[model samples]
Target: MLIGVLLVISWLILLIRYPTKALPISMAALAGLALVASWVLWEENRDARYLAHLELRLSYDPQQCPGDRPLAVRLKNGSDAALLELRWEVAAYRPGNATNLAQRLYESPRYSGPGELLPGASWNDCLPLPDLRSGYRPSTLEFRAERLQGQFIR
Candidate 1:
């Protein structure tokens, strides 16, 4: 919608500038389309840069525990801009299955008091897994990271 408005304005400007030209109308429309396309492409490039500034990784050491152990999360920030208002969740599943046996949501202390993540910084948090019934070992675990506005930048 915004691009449309911009294109219309550009077209009007071109038409006003070259009203007597043989193909003034067509030229104005094409110029307007070009302007809108350029704007869209620039915005997409900017968003890509912003996204590239951050990274998310999930890691665990199975050897750290004998059998059922608590889950540990490692959030690393690789961007120059501090990530404001970050939230994370951890879920345990039967390794390869999609069903989650246990899940926990935690707000990182680093960002608890309206904090932000600085560049090249990292945080480690742990959540203890409860004792499960026999034959309930989680084969897979998943972690998700996102910003305050539901933007999954990581």
Candidate 2:
């Protein structure tokens, strides 16, 4: 909003100062600024729009044998964009605890699908515990994918 106001004010000042040249210069400048602003807005929001359709699920699976990955992971993509990669931040907390006891990051090397995760595809797998501490059990688990830097095919 401020930018729009400033641009208008500057254009008006230029028009008053140099009536002949101001029209062409101001038009060119405004056109360039508009193009740059649109590109920036599109780049910033494209990822978020695609990621909004991603569904993630996590659980602690004790049935898995010890020394094996115990965190169950299920991800579904409901958008039309194909995801080239994904990363998640996992957090574990004791029951009724506000503070997390452990945290880890998981990065998917490849999609379970034949290629990049296509639209409406799902991936299921298990992840290792954040820590190797014996008898560690977290009643509360959390997953965050805010750092999704993956390539998307629209």
Locate the minimum summed-lDDT window of 10 residues in model 1: 105-114
lDDT of 1: 0.53
* Per-residue lDDT over 83-140 for candidate 1, one digit per residue giving the tens place of the 0 to 100 score: 5555444344555676655433343222221256666777665544533335664444
Model 1 residue pairs with clashes: 95-139, 95-140
What is model 2's C-alpha RMSD? 6.4
lDDT (tens digit, per residue) of candidate 2 on 1-154: 9999998799789899998999888789889999999998997688778877888776777575244666677788888989886665555555565565453334423223223788998987776656523455544455333345555777
Q: Listing every candidate in turn, what is its Cα RMSD in Å to the true structure after a full C-alpha superposition?
A: 8.6, 6.4
- What lDDT would each prediction earn against the true structure? 0.53, 0.67
Instruction: Using lDDT, give the best candidate's number.
Output: 2
Q: Candidate 1: deviation at residue 21, Å?
A: 36
